[model samples]
Target chain A: MSALFEFCLRMGDNTLVLGHRVSEWCGHAPVLEEDIALANTALDLIGQTQMWLGLAADVEGQGRSADDLAFLRDAWDFRNLLLVEQPNGDFGVTMMRQFLFDAWHLGQLETLIDSADDRVSAIAQKAIKEVTYHFDRSSGLVIGLGDGSDESHARMQTALDLLWPFAGEGFEADATDLELAGAGIAPNPAGLRAAFDARVEQVLQRATLSLPESRFAHRGGRTGARHSEHLGHMLATMQVLQRSYPGATW
Target chain B: MTPIAQVWEWLDAVPDPEIPVISVTDLGIVRDVDWEDGTLIVTVTPTYSGCPATSVIAMDIETALRDHGVDRIAIRQQLAPPWTTDWLKPAARDKLKTYGIAPPQPAGGPESCPHCGSANVERISQFGSTPCKAQWRCRDCLEPFDYFKCI
Candidate 1:
């Protein structure tokens, strides 16, 4: 695939997988309100994936539709961030994961709004608005849960600790990102780290939570060379119906 | 007959797919209409970035124009200036209240029950049946309603 196609897939795959992860909580959220809120965010992310992947398919000069690209890809060929593929252990963990990703995503989208590519800029313009609300909702919940009762506070802290290491992967720019960044079609992922850290730290402070100091991290999802074991399981379920009844439609 | 004006009039009859009570023009999604090189072009913006209704709305706009004998039509999507609840017509707000959906309030503004006009209301959820609304309930009337949340 071309570098532009790869870059678009990276964007699309991240949102597609994360959207699926969030959608898993549709009926299982702690409260009815949260269930609705999380589902809405999921729909937004999934909708975004359609636009990105649709663009990617065109860039590749492939006849594949967005649905074909989404449903037919194997886990090993997927390029979503490691953090997005992580299991939703609890509501606290789920919110923490979302908060971290949203913070990074806000910076990414804001910078992308000025991209040299018009379509990318237009998509970013629309996406930043929705992502802003996602960040607000998740960050507010992080603070509330982190500063709440003893049990709630501890759970929130545990969630943060467990998810922190994976947060670094978001800032890792591979060959595709670096090429796009050089061409001004994409932002340098590294340039966004400081802003992401500042936002996360400020929220953690209000939540009475401390940032993890560990320097350990994992990578490789961007290149699609490897993925967490969780991805395979999720994809199995996500693509089962498609695999079973090829060309079926409602 | 003024064909361009008639096109706008036909567009005013196109009801929003989700909220059938208000027309797309009344909701302000229809930003501009003009004739260009023998083609009628209608510009629109989606209410939400990920709203599933955008394509449907675009199709509806075309069908509405075609039904009125307009041959060549071009529907354009513009995203530079984002859509906001502020664009909702004043008359549309009153219609929303009558539809049991509280119109969007100014940020941090007081919210009242649409059913009995009671200020004694509480938010049930930050989301409702549609992405644009939030769920709320009135303590006085004991009725649940959708609040058109501020974007």
Candidate 2:
């Protein structure tokens, strides 16, 4: 498989799975504006997955459409980071995950905008703009919930500790990632670690939430061989339509 | 350019559903407007992530151009090149500012109010009157206006 195509699938799968997770909050956000905001962001992210995976299908020369990649793949067959597949525990957990990932994603997109690869650059130029607002909104919520009142701060702090392990995988480089990073189509995940840390620290400190010292970085969730139990449960809902009726298009 | 191309040249006049003064082409939402195999194909990007108006825009494009008798018109929604206010034709920006909604600030920078020209607009809400826009109030104008939030 071409590294770039595989890379695209990896990226697309992360958004696809997590977007589904976030969409579950459509009618259930604590506030109405946030409900619409998260759902809208989910729509954008899923749309982005379709584009990247469609291109991935073309590159793989497998006649696999975006639907095939998204709906056909089993939990173990997905290549997304473990962090994205982690369960959305509560609003606090959701915002924590979103804030962490959005911060990294925004920075990554900013760097990708000028990628030597034209396709990556084009998508990044567009996606980065969207993620910028996404990051701001998510980070804003993280701060609000983390430092608002005693109850709010305690709940948010607990969410942060729960999610800390998964956050490490985002910064680690695997074999395929290193290869793609060398191609100049993607930035080195290792390089983004500092930027991600700094941004998160700023938000956490403002939220009066101390950073957890736990560094038992979770890894090896990609390569399509294994997944958290969360993936199987999420897929039950996500793939329901495609699994029931194959090739059904609107 | 074929007669279909000629028709496309005419369809270029279709104003954006939101920004009526500017054609969809100038807004960069209309990625491709052309004829293929006796069919007219038009591609558009949603103004933001989930602008419900995209379907309206597609239908509007077809209804507007159907008068020319194009057998089939397809509006392919491509989200790869996400829509940006920067894509707004310069002319459209001027029209937007004149029309009361602030134009998007240039990319790689923070946005400013289209009303009182202040960088001090605060985001009041993420969803505006439409999905593509966010509710931002100009601290200077003390007036709430929509920021053409990107997707």
Candidate 3:
């Protein structure tokens, strides 16, 4: 119920669900190197999710372990944004999703490093290097495809358009964010939006891809608890082991 | 021998989960295998921070240590001094090649095909089965192979 734990869940759950989604590409990625990278990046973020959520569970004293929080929770209980829950349609679509998230994540982490909440700040600082490289690799692909042949360019463009609406949730400030913002312990997503936009725009320009002029932006990804069908499938895979063999340890 | 020396000898045989021929010791990641105070402390540097194999690595190390009747084991991860390709033993390189996945090489700004020993290899995609490798293809051989991605 405390603001600190809630904020940590907001952060941790996002990575947890997204990492679960990415890890599905293991042994299935179009190429060997990509499979490794996707799975590894997924590993990195999922590891962080475990830490922050465990810390959150400890602080909350809710009798819930990190594993419980991760696997036992239902779709409505998950706090990840809808964008992360979207299915990996294709290589281009997955790259676009990653690029969009990376841009916003980079901005948030850049500010999070200065957060008064030192644990989150330290984690953010340590994670920055990894995310930066992830962004670079994703961005390179974005540009490469965006500027490539007509089919490739058009497909990436379509992916860009489809994923744009989900980007809005990363910038929305809720009561929890406002509370932590007051403590200088939470990142100001709204503040980071301008920078995120600038960085993403620059990359999009280099890619020579045009953003569709859609005035419509989707909201309620966090609070509404509505999600794509993809999330239920993801949770099914991720939650099975924990649910089946309760309290199983390493 | 002291417990430290004993632990090292015991650990020298633990094979990597993915790369079976290369022992953790041969990877230069098993920094210190010793008894500190009452517990066995095994220090390790990850080949890369998010190595999916790390959990397995830790599990393997713990199992190996405990199987030798050494309990109270703690695996401390050290990431401050980064890992490089140079840490892999020369024998491991040959082992990797024999296994069909080439060993890591310096980036040299571009990747080379591990199968045909040509510089004409190009990246096919960035996501591979694991984080430590990249999917590359040999233009000459037209064979897809894993490039031990540089950290």
Candidate 4:
């Protein structure tokens, strides 16, 4: 596969997986407001996935649509970060995951707005606006819950610790990333680390949450070498309708 | 040939699927209208990326034009110059207020309850029933309302 296609998949799959995970909270969130917010966030991410994967299909010249790319692909073919595919353990865990991802996602999109490729830049331009709101909401909730009470604080801290290792994979660059970065089509994921760290540190401090001091990065999800077992189960449910019917449409 | 101006008038009559009080054109989503090689091209932008009404709005536009006997119609989605609440027409804002949905404000939240016209409104949630709205409640009237959130 071409590096551009691979890059687009990485971008698309992250949103698709995370969007699905967030959507799982639609009726189950702790409160009505939270339920609506989570659902809205999920919708924005899924919409972005359509754009990125649509571009990926166009670049591949394979006649595959975005829906086909999303539903037909198995876990092994996905290029999302392990952090996004991780289970939404609890409300706190989900928010922590979202906050971490949004931090990096915001920075990445900001840089992407200046991408050498117009399509990539255009997608970023559109996505950044929605992502800015996502980051605002997620980070605000992180601070609110983390500083609220003893129980909330403890859960937020635990979530941060549990999800931190997976966060590093977002910054790890591979050959596809290198080629895109070299061509000015995209930023090297590694270069986004500093901004990510600064944002995380600032938010965690305000949230009264401690950042886990582990730099032990998880590898493989973005590379498609391996994924967490959670991914397969998630995909099974996500792709079930399409997989069963082959070409179902509303 | 139907004048492009006539096409705009027809589109202006098509109500937004989500906010029926305002037409898609009133929402400023109908970016441009022109004729290209005998095909009527209507360019639109979505209020929010995940807005479920985008496809519906396009269909509504097409159906409205087709009813006017303009068969060669093409609806194109544009992303550049992303849609903002600022694009909402002044008349649309008045209509939204009359419909009990607060129009967007540059202050990032509703300035007053659309129903009570009281400045005692508080945000209930940053999100609402639709992607483009937020839930708010009037402190004086104790009635909850949807506010078109600024992007």
Q: lDDT per prediction? A: 0.88, 0.78, 0.78, 0.92
Q: What does candidate 2's lDDT look like per residue over A1-250, in tens digits?
A: 7888878888788889878989999899888777878888888788678667877888889788888989988887787878888887888899888888898788778788878888778777667766777888888888988879898899899988888888887777777778888888888888988888898999999999988898788776757766788888889889999899887888
Output the number of the TM-score-best candidate.
Answer: 4
After superposing candidate 2 on the true structure, give the runs of residues whose Cα lies further than 4 Å from its correct spot.
B1-9, B12-23, B31-46, B49-66, B70-82, B89-122, B136-147
lDDT winner between 1 and 3, please give it: 1
TM-score for every candidate vs. truth? Answer: 0.91, 0.83, 0.78, 0.98
Ten-residue stretch with the least lDDT total in model 1 chain A: A215-224
Going through the candidates in order, their DockQ values are 0.59, 0.39, 0.27, 0.82
The TM-score that candidate 2 achieves is: 0.83
Task: State in Å the error of residue B53, model 4.
Answer: 0.4
B76 Cα displacement, candidate 1 (Å): 4.2
TM-scores for chain A over all candidates: 0.98, 0.96, 0.95, 0.99
Angstrom error at residue A9, model 3: 1.8
Return the lDDT, model 1, position A3. Answer: 83
Quote the true-contact fraction of every model. Answer: 0.55, 0.43, 0.35, 0.76
Clashing pairs in 1: none
User: Which scores greater on TM-score, model 2 or model 4?
Assistant: 4
Q: Quote model 1's TM-score for chain B.
A: 0.94
Q: Any runs in candidate 3 off by more than 4 Å, and if so which?
A: A23-45, A61-63, A89-92, A111-122, A125-130, A178-186, A213-216, A223-250, B1-6, B26-37, B43-50, B76-120, B138-145
Instruction: Highest DockQ: give the candidate number.
Output: 4
**Cα lDDT tens digits for candidate 3, A1-250:** 7888877787788888878888888889876567767877888778768666877898889798887888888887777778888998999999999999999888888888888976777667656766777898899989999999999999999999999988878898988889889999977678888898889899999998987776365665566357667778888888888889988877
